[model samples]
Structures are given as structure tokens and as C-alpha cells.
Target: MDEVEVVVAHSERATLRVGDVFLKVDTDQARIDVEVEVMTLAPVPTPEVLWRKPPVLALAAVPGTTLGSLGGPSTGSPAAWAAAGATIRKLHDAPLPPLRGRSGRSIAALTAELDDECELLVTNGLLPADLVTRNRQIAETALRPWTPAFTHGDLQIAHVFVEGDEVTGIIDWSEAGQGDALSDLATFTLGHEEHLDDVLAGYGTDVDLDVIHAWWSLRSLLAIRWLNEHGFDPFAPGCEVDVLRSRM
Candidate 1:
């Protein structure tokens, strides 16, 4: 067996090599800080493979252990939720560069992506028909008249680090883009409903709760379907399924 110097490891991602420098950004007044690491993996022939490449060395200086860790504080706790909310606000407040690839500015494009994902999952027998219908309806409802903001598409406790009542940093930028702020907020709420009020309060604005709830529900359903189709059990540690299920 070979060994690699592991800096951080979770079901979905890992980081190694401490001295590797990557892109870092912080917006304190807005309350966000990010560090981006270039991946060391060699590029595969396929573009799809390229999209799936891991960071060569990824690291984010978040405060506490991930909220979803077995022995860590539950994300449902008010303080924990507040911390998560603050972290998200910071991310949202950060200055964003133009989206590199496809412009995610269109609601139609976003809806199409969601629909296609659902269809693929359904075709593979990974999602129940009723759930698919519900998910589609919710996705459509939530996406209509969407408002764009710098968003971390994957906003979950696992990607967030907290210390006491403060969020130190956020990790993972693979799913980031300029998109609906509410969608990002929804992702957080769905994954951390236990801290709903505190999170919203930290957000410092009145948000449409229904839209956020719908988006989160749809996001969870999609995640479940993807896990099922991929033969990945959500209950296992370090698995995307586990992260999603933990939110529930």
C-alpha cells in the first residue's frame, strides 16, 4: 500500500500538500474568504473527465470541524445554523468573475439542466415517478424569475467550517457560478433546516421562504437520484449521499 500526505479528507473531496499555493480571495465586509487550488491530476482525453478532475491541492481555512462530522455540532443548532448563514453571506458578498463556460444566467438553461438530470435518473430507475414530478414542479417554481448573485452552487455544512459563532472559511468551488442567490440560500436551508431562522436572520433580509424551501427540496431529490444511479449509498461516510441524507 502506498501513502499520500493527506491534509483533509471527506467522502467527496480531499486535499494534500501544504505548501501548494492556489488562488485565495477574501471580502471581510461582505464576510467571505476562499482559496482555490490547482489540481495535480493529469488531464484525461475526454472533456467530461476534465470536468471531473480533482484539485491538485485544495484547502480552505474554515473554523471548526465540518458541521456534518459525526462528533461535531449538529447544523440544526441555532448557533451552528447562524454560523452557516454568515458563511454563506460572505460567499455571496464576494466579488465574482465572469462565468468561464456556459453562462448560467438563463432560467431556461438552468431548468433544462435540472430536467435532463431528472430524466437521466428516471431512465436509470434511480428516482420514483412521484418524486420526479414533485421535483420538476418545485424546480420550475423556484427558478422562475430567478435573481443572479455570486453563488456557491453546493452550499452544505460539509463544505462550511465554523468556529464558535463565526464561519472561518468555505471550501469547494467546483459548482460555483453567477446564478440565483435564492437558489444558493435554498441549498443551505434544505441541508440545514434546523437552523432556518438563525440563518435567515444572519442573511439580513427578508427572503421568499417558499422559494428557498422548494429549491432545497428539489435539490435533495436530485441528489438522492444521482446517488442511487451511481451505486453510491448516501448513508456511507465521505459519500455525497451521506452529506445529503445528513441534512434531512
Candidate 2:
């Protein structure tokens, strides 16, 4: 294999370097098996408050290159959806380390966080109070029967790599945690409904689609509420709210 070049770097966690090996960890997971070539790590500046730290290394092969991010269209399409579902199922089946943090699966806790975020946004004059309330209701109503499982909190098309009908690799383990499995499914389903059945079929088990749908709805509301309060349009490309709304 040829050496992959370092094309992009994200913070201090990971860098996309040239000549790096892309080994497949099962059918879902993939990682850089080599040390980064550069020493200086940069910080990502953003106003969005996060629940956890991002990954250390985030890299992918160049498009049309030997080790590109697999193949197929980028996001929310049928091919991308199938790949995402397959990858997530594989990840969920992997053994996980013991969780050592408070759970975010509870409606009250999620609502509290949403409330605080709304207050912050309103204080900054970014959104209306009524919209915040509406979003809160949506969140509370959507997240029912809170069961937790190991979830890829940031599951999306860009995070998954596909080559034809098979999933090449699943990338980005930053927001991973012990949470509701359905939430992970919902996270993907919210964007690509066409592949919902296929994705679930890939799981090879009976999963409650309603539960997944609820989780997706609640997640969408929370994300959109945050974006709206921050004075940014929630429908922009790469926007979490937009991705969620596409499902609705």
C-alpha cells in the first residue's frame, strides 16, 4: 500500500496524514494504526458547548484516492443510509468499557440541559422563548421508555464509509457512550427514512422502531433548538438540526 498524505488535521486528537494504513476493525470500525507525523496539535474554536471531548485523530483518505472514504454519495441518500445502519449495528455489538458518568437518557436531565441552553440563547437574543418551550415539549414527548445502550452519539453519513453495498468502515468514536441503542438507530433513521427498514433488517433482531423514532425526534428538537438560539440557521448543510429535520 502507498503512504497516505496528511491532508487535514482536527485539533490535537487526530490528523489525516498521507501514507497511513487504514485497517478495518471488523465490518464497522477503522482507525489509523500509525503515529501522527507532526507534533504540533491545534485547537478547534467553537461556541457550541459539548457534553464530552472530541476524538484525538480524525482523518480520511482523499476522494478518488487509494484510501478515500470508501465510495457512494455523501449524506442521507439510500446508499449512505444502508452503510450507516450496517456500521452502527456492528459497533453496538462490540464489547464496551464500563461507563463512569451520569446518564443523559432521562427526559428530565435532557430537558434541563435544553432549558439551560434555551435560556443562554434567549439571553443572547438569538431565539424566542415560545420556540424554546415548544422544543422542550417535543423533547419530552419524543423520549419515552428511556432504555440505554452503547451508542455512537454522532452517527451520520459523513461518519460512515462505504464501498458499494458493503460498509468499508465506521469512523469517529468521540461521542460514543453507554446509552439507548434505539437512539443510535433513530439518529441515523431521522435523516434517511428510505433505508430505515433495510438498516433495521441488517440488525438481524427485533428492535422497536417506535422507540427509535421517538429518540430521533427528541434528538432533532434539541439540536435545532440549540442552533436557533445561537443565532444561526438550523437548516444549513452539515447542521445537525437540518439533518434531523430532513427525516421529519
Candidate 3:
């Protein structure tokens, strides 16, 4: 290896890029197992798996810049965002991957979790009580039942890679499983609301905006605390906090 570049580092896992290979290090074996299996099953392009050993998975790097960064404008064209939407649609249509744990949860469970997170936010003064309550109310609309689809689970903009208006690949499959298709859409468009039309046009289907908005609130509320603890600031300009406030 010539030199190593840290791609992402937090408490749970760290990814490093050296030469043309990316090394993902995580103490959790089950997460690695899911990543490998989900990549094999995913319909869209993904980084090629070079090899894997305990606590380390080496992957051939995908040749493209990431689609965008959180809290920042994407240089990718509208066409590129649309291409990503099409890719996500294809993934949702693929066969579901088998996993050892629960791929999704019931509405009751999601609601319970949301309630707990909201309480924590309020109690800790992490957010204004009114803001948290309003977002929580907005999030409730997404708890309705839906047919399970193959979902990427964490389709943040940074996970999608593109080159010349084409989506080359998506990275990070640890959370892939059967879940709400809208969740992927909501996640991808979280901080990039301006591109929603492009993505929806390429999705080639009608989606309920209310459900998408609900998911936006749900995901942001659930993730804000953990993101902060992990050295990510969801409250940064145009990030998750902004996404939530946009609802009000």
C-alpha cells in the first residue's frame, strides 16, 4: 500500500482507501456478513468484493465521485440524480437478501422507538420541545403498512457514486434488507430536496409526498443523536435539522 486515506471513521466502523482497494474495518461480524451477501443480491452496481477476513473487508474501489455530500450542493447534474433514482427502483425490484436479524419492524415498534427518541431529545435539550413534537407528529404519517421491498436501508447521497451523469455504483450495504421502498427514497433525498423532482421523474412511478415527508422526519429524528455522537453534525446547514425544519 502506498498511502492510506480514511474514508469514514466513527465508533462503529472505519473505512480506509489505499491504492485502488478500500478496507472496511468493523468489530461486528454479522454486519460484514450482511454486506457481502447483500452485494451479491443487489441488482444495481456495487463495488466488487476483493476479499474479507475477520474485522476487515477489502473491496475494489468504484471509479466515480460520490453523488453528493450531506449539507452541500451536489455538482452532479439533474440527470445524474434521476439515474440514481432509476437505480434505486431497480434495487427495490430485486430479490430480497436473507439476513439473520429483523429486516424491518412493525408500525407499533417504529412508533415506540420514535417516541423514545423524541423524549430523549426533549429531556436532553438537544432540540426545542416544540420542534421535536411537530416533527414527531409529521413522522407518524409514515407508519402505515406497505408491501416489503428490497431496500438499501442507508441510501444517503454520499453512498451513491456517479461519473458523467451515470450512477456508477453505491457503497455501504450493511443495512440492506426488506423494508419500505420510500425509506430509501427519503434517505437519498434527505438533504437534497431540490432534486426531488428529478428523482421522482426517473423513479417512473407516483409516490405519496406525505409519506416521503413523514419518512424524512422519522429518519432525521431517529438519527440526529447518534450522528452527533459519531462526530457528524446533522444540524449543519442544509442537513437533517434543516430537513426537519423545512416541514414546519
Candidate 4:
């Protein structure tokens, strides 16, 4: 009998690993719909879908280990990171997914949500007034219009898998859609600022550093409250709080 490993579990969804297979149990079928659809449309390598039973979508685990995770030291070589970057560029160049920008959200909607979160951070004393204000101002640069691309809307480093400096697969496609390319870049290099140059090198394009900086601040500010509520520590070493402090 294969031992069951609880990969991740929260109020909204959970992932379980049994042997070489991964079971993604999501309450929202719409997200599952997107995940299944985007995998077919995306040009990049993805996990093999073994089966789906409503809430439980089974996937065959892809080869290679993860690229590392947030608040943790990265183990992949510079070449591996570059390969990940190149893979991302390929995905961006692919045709848009069936769904629009990560749940069809517009820049205006995101801006409004950002402002509301900033206000809450200040009003509830969750963060220092000065810190929230400064980051909020910095976050404004990311609010402007951007060209939509096929984006891994939540392109965290851990989502990418690599083998011997080659990208094997990218996962977590529920957020994949037509969205800002820089948004994906910002998420990938959020805390790993040292790897930004390497990523951009393989990305092989010019990018707005200020906009990247803005996304860092904006993403951290919006995420702190949710993380705190969701049994995660935004204030952990090398985590969201540290990322925010770096801007100051």
C-alpha cells in the first residue's frame, strides 16, 4: 500500500500525494476547469493528468525536483534558473488561454483591491502606517496598463521543476491566463532578488525595474493579511515582511 502524504490543505482546497500520483481536491470547479484547459493550451511542459473525479483531479507527478521555495534557500544552479526563465518566456509567447486575465480581473479592479488592502493594513495596525503608505505609493507603478501574455499568474519559484539545468515542468495552472508578463516575472523573483539578473538574461528582454519593484511592494502588502489569516507567517525571515523592508 502506498503511504499518503498530505501535500497541502486549507479551507478552500487540498493536495495529496500517494505514491507517484498527486490528487488535487478543489472546491471550485471553475478553477479546475481552467487548470485542465490551460494545460492543453500551454506550450510548456506540464504534469500528466491521470484522471479526474469532480473535486479530486489526479495527476501523474512530473520528473525533477522543485526550483526551491520562498523564505528558503534556493538549491538550483544559475543555469537551472535561467532555463526556468527561458521556459517562462516560451509560455508567454504561447497563445492566450481560454480564460482571460486570472479570473478576468482588470487593472482597475486590482488597483481598487490594492487600495482597500492598503487601507486595512493601515487602519488595523497590521503594519506600520509609514510602511504601508510607502509600499502603497510604490505599488502604484504596477497599476498601469500592460500587454497581456499567456502568464503563470502565480509563478512562484516552487512551481517550476528542473533537471540538470533543464526545465522539466511547471505546475499550478489554476491561475494561468492572459495577464501582464511582468506580473509573472515579479512573482517568480519576488524574494530572490539576486536571481533577477539571471532570469532577465534568459528572459532575453528589457523590463522596467521600477515596475518590478512596485509589484514586489504591492504583492507583499496585499498578501500579508491573507497569509496571517491562513496559518502562514508573512513576518518570517526572508518572507514578505523582509521583502517589504528591503524597499525602505
Cα lDDT tens digits, model 4, 1-248, are 99999987878889999999999999899999989999988998999999999989999998999877889987788888888889999999997776785623688899889989989988888899888888889999998888789998889888899999999888889988898888888999989999988888888767899998999998899899998887889999888989999998
For each candidate in turn, give its C-alpha RMSD to the true structure in angstroms.
9.3, 9.9, 1.4, 1.2
User: Sorted by TM-score, highest first, which candidate order results?
Assistant: 4, 3, 1, 2
- Highest TM-score model number: 4
Clashing pairs in 1: 11-238, 31-90, 39-55, 39-56, 40-56, 64-162, 234-241, 234-242
lDDT of all predictions, in order shown?
0.53, 0.48, 0.88, 0.88
Instruction: List model 2 lDDT by residue over 1-248, tens digit each.
Output: 67655443323233334354332222111222111211011011111211212233333432221112212233334554555565667656655424411223466676676667657646766445665455555455455555555555655545455555556544444455566677667665555555678776666457876566656546655566544555546665534444444343
| Candidate 2, run of 10 with poorest lDDT | 37-46
lDDT of 3 by residue, 1-248 (tens): 47999999999999999999999999999899899898998889999999998899999999889867889877788898889889999998877767522326788888898999999988988899989999999998899988788888898899999998788899999998888889889999998888888998788767988999899999999999989889989889998888888888
Candidate 3 has a TM-score of 0.96
Model 2 scores a C-alpha lDDT of 0.48
Compared to the true structure, candidate 2 yields what TM-score?
Answer: 0.58
Q: Report the lDDT tens digits of candidate 1 across residue range 79-172.
A: 7667667666765665653542122447677677777777876787765566567656755667677546667666665666666666655655
The lDDT, on a scale of 0 to 1, for candidate 3 is 0.88
Model 1 error, position 179 (Å): 1.6
User: Which residue window of length 10 is worst by lDDT in model 3?
Assistant: 95-104
Q: How far in Å is the alpha carbon of 91 misplaced in model 4? A: 0.5
Model 3 residue 188 lDDT score: 93
